[model samples]
Structures are given as structure tokens and as C-alpha cells.
Target: MAAGGSRPEPFVVSSVEKVHRVMSWLKEIFGSQSLPPFEKNSETFDLLYTLAEYSEERERDASVLIEDMKERAAKYDAEAEYLQSILTETFDLSPSVLSEEGSAHLKTLVDTAMILDTKDTSLASLFSAISDRSLELLAAETKNKELELNLLEVRNKLTATLALENQLRMDLKKAEKDLEVEEAKAHFRLQNLQFLKHKSEDISIRIKSAEEKLIAIGLQESLMHEPLMKLSQKLAEVQEETVQVKKKLECYFNLPTSLPLARVKIEEAKRELNALEEKVSMRIEEMTDDFLELERL
Candidate 1:
């Protein structure tokens, strides 16, 4: 970028003023025809001409440096934007948002390029001014690197959160599968108990018939007593099994409640990720607009 704008030559103006003042002084000292010889004063006029040329050359050099600076600033800005676009594409961000973020980093360089030594129109001052702009560019470049590192950090964080989200989802699915298996087991146990209860009722009827037969035929009572006692004990065991099955089924039925909590955590994570993305986008947009204005300067 240009260090400064073109300015009126100070030497040229002062030289003219000096010549006018000398003539006025000479006219006061001597009448027009009796003025000092031209040969005696030629050297002074030569010096004035030299000063004018020197001033012109200095101004031209400053102008050229300023133009060169402007070109360099523009090229750097373009390259910064191009690199930002590539990074955005690789990272899966909106182009406008990333582009603006990149431009924000170049704002300082752009502003520095627009600096001009219009007021102090001297080579030394112009050079100093250009040097200051170079310093500003260096600082801006440093800040740009910092910004890139920060962006990378954010991307890494996002990636980690996404991975966590996937893991959570897989856990939820596994939980669901486990609950289903428990439910199926509970259902089978309940069915088995009901079938056993039906069989026990039939055994009770057979034991009653065996008792009537034994009384009519005068058979020993011990045989009837053993079978009846065994049938009663089996019936008691089936009832106990039914109770245990109900308890297990109830426990499995409550498993679904935990699922909702797990799902809620995943949803919370998703919301956080979305909010982060929105914040980044909004900040980039604002910075981009501000930087663009600075570039125009």
C-alpha cells in the first residue's frame, strides 16, 4: 500500500518565495538598473533549481512507494480471502462467514497501506511512514496467525462434541436393546407360570378322584396322601414363580424412563453445538463488514 498521498512540493514553493523575497530585498538595496550583476547571483538560482528538482524527486519516490504498498496490500488481502475460502470448504463452514473472518485479519494491513505522508512531504518522513506500515503489517500477520489457531481450536472442539454425541446415541440404542431382552424374558417366565398353574389344578382333581377310589376299594391311604402332598407343594412353587416374574417385569418396564434422560442429554449437546455455530457465524459477519470498511480506507 501507498505510505501517503501526493502532496504539493514544499521546496518548490519555498524556492519561489525565497526568489521573490531576494528580488524585493535587492530592489530595496539598489534601483532596478543599478542591481547586482546577474553573474554574481546565478549560483543562488542554480541552487533553487536543484532544490526544486530534489523536492520533486522525493515526492515522486514517496508516491511510488505508496502505490507499491497499496498493490502489496491488495494482493495479500486477496490471498488471505482465497485461503480462508479453502479452509472453510475443508471445514464445512458457510463461505461468507469464513470469508469475512479472513478479511477481518487483513484489515490492519489494508489500513496501513492507506497511510500517506501528505503533510510532512519529505523523503525521510515518507520512509519512516512506510516503515511504520511495514511494522503494522507484521503485527497484523501475527494476529492473523493467532486467529487461525483459535479457529482450529474451535473446529477441534466441535469434532470432539460430535463424537461424544455419536457415542451417546449408540449407548442409548444398546440400552433399548437390553430393556427389550429383559421384557422378553419376563414375558416368557409369566407364560410358564400360568401353564404350570393350569397343570397343578388338573393334578388336584386327579388326587381327589384317587382318594374316592382308595376309600371304595379299601387301598392303603399312604399312597393317596403322598401324591396329594406333592401336588400341593408344586402348586405353591408355581405361585412363588408368578410373584417373582411380576417383580422382574415391573423392573424392566421402568427401564424406559432412563432412556428419556439419555435422549435429553444428547439434545442438550446438540443445542450447545448449534449455539456455538451461530455465535461464530454472527461474529464473523460483523467482523467482516467492519474489516471491509477499513480496507476501503
Candidate 2:
């Protein structure tokens, strides 16, 4: 202070100022309601320093008091260590932040971020993609459902068709059975007709042989053919009786007897020389019974 041409004692802390500063510090620390305002800065740190310079605790430098405390240790000297604790609580010096270069890039991106026109462009694209995917899924599901329905329909149709085919097969089997019965009956009748034809042929051969015998016995010329005339008359009577029996059979059976009788001849030149005896006649008894049964039928 003397080298700078200033009075050292006047500039130094005075007794009254020190007292005033200490009072101010006390007010800051304990809150003295009776203390008045100070002339200058009324901060607690300023007051404490001013008071310390004049008090017995004075040292050459504040560093000597601070010593190893470094941060606000002096503020907690007479108190419950509250102010120093608050100072330490407010700061965090842990090295947990990202690198400086990464922070700068992130800051630039944040500062230049785009916040316009995206409502129209980005939302439209997202909505279109979503709609397309939804439509595709819907179509695929519909197709699968339709295929299932078609499969069910096809199965139903197949079942119906099989049922119909089975019914037709049953009908065909019944018809075939009926047809077989009819064929058997028809074949039996055909064999009967052929047998009748063979019997007629045998009867004709026998009659021819008898007529030859009668001719050898002079039955044709002697007595002016009396035996031949009688034989012819008898043949005529037999033919008349056969016609009547045929008519009875035809009338009763509602059939045309002409079909069976058309092959038989009634003319003298054709049928006059009959030979079979009445007892040996094959057609007599059976033909008579057949005519009677036909009339009843």
C-alpha cells in the first residue's frame, strides 16, 4: 500500500468495519433480526473475510486458512456444515458424457432437424404400404375360404353321384335278373317247339311206312278201294275233330290256333292215306287234355 502512494493503515480493515462485517456475517449465518444494513456488499463470504483480517484469526493469505479444504470448507466452520454440503451437492464432475466430437455431431443434427412436409409424404407412404398389405392378406384369406367351400361342394357332388350310380347299379342288377328269368323261360319254350317239330316228323315217317304195308296187302285196289275209302273217311273225321279241338284251344287261350294248324293239310290228296292206329296215336289223349285245359284257362 505505501509503494502505491496510499495510506496502508486506513486501507486495512478497521475495528468498527470488522465489527460491522462480523455482525453482517452473523446475520447471514444465524439471521440477526436486530442488525442494520451494511455500507457495501452484504454477502456472508465478504463479511467473513473482512472480519477475519481484523480478528485474531488473521493470516498472511486466505489460502493458509483454506489449506487442504480447496472448495467451501471455511463456510462450514461454525455451522452444521450445511453451506459447504450444498456447494458440493450442486456440482457433478464424473466423466460419463459422450465424446466431444460425437456431442458436436448430435448437436448439429438436432439444430438442423427437419419438422415439415413429413405429415403429407411419410404418412402417405406408410398408409399406402399398410393398405396394400391388408388387401393382399384379405385376398389370400378369401381365396383359401373359397377353395375350402369348393372342396366341400365337390365332396358333396361326389357323394351324390356315387349314390346315384349305386342306385342305378341296383336297378341294372334287378333288370338283369328279370331278363335272365325271361330268357330261361323263352329257351324252354323254344326247346318245346323243336321237340314238337321232331315228333311231327316221326309221326309222318310212321304213317308212310303203314301206307306202304297197306298197299302190299292190296288195300288200295280190291273191292273198289273199300278199305281205302273207309280209311280216308276216318282220316277226314279225325281232321274235323282236330280242327274243333284247335278252335276250342284258340278261343279259350285268346291265341291264334292257325299258327300251329297251318302246317296240317285237310285235302284228300295230301292227307287221305293215314296209317297210325287210334290206340297208338300220340296226339289223341294229350291233345284232348290240352284243348280242355286251354278252354278252362
| Winning candidate number (TM-score) | 1
lDDT of each: 0.68, 0.59
Off by over 4 Å in 2: 1-137, 221-297
lDDT of 1 by residue, 249-294 (tens): 4544545546987566556655655665575566556546644653
Per-candidate RMSD, Å: 43.1, 36.9
Compared with the true structure, model 2 gives a TM-score of 0.28
Instruction: Tell me the spans in candidate 1 whose CA falls farther than 4 Å from its real position.
Output: 1-114, 225-297
User: Tens-digit lDDT track for model 2 on 90-207?
Assistant: 6522223546876686455433332221212245654665576779889999999999999999999999999999999999999999999999999999999999999999988887
The per-candidate count of clashes, in order, stands at: 9, 0
Query: Which residue pairs collide in model 1, if any?
Result: 1-69, 1-70, 2-66, 2-70, 3-66, 3-115, 3-116, 4-116, 4-117
lDDT of predicted model 1: 0.68
TM-score of each: 0.36, 0.28
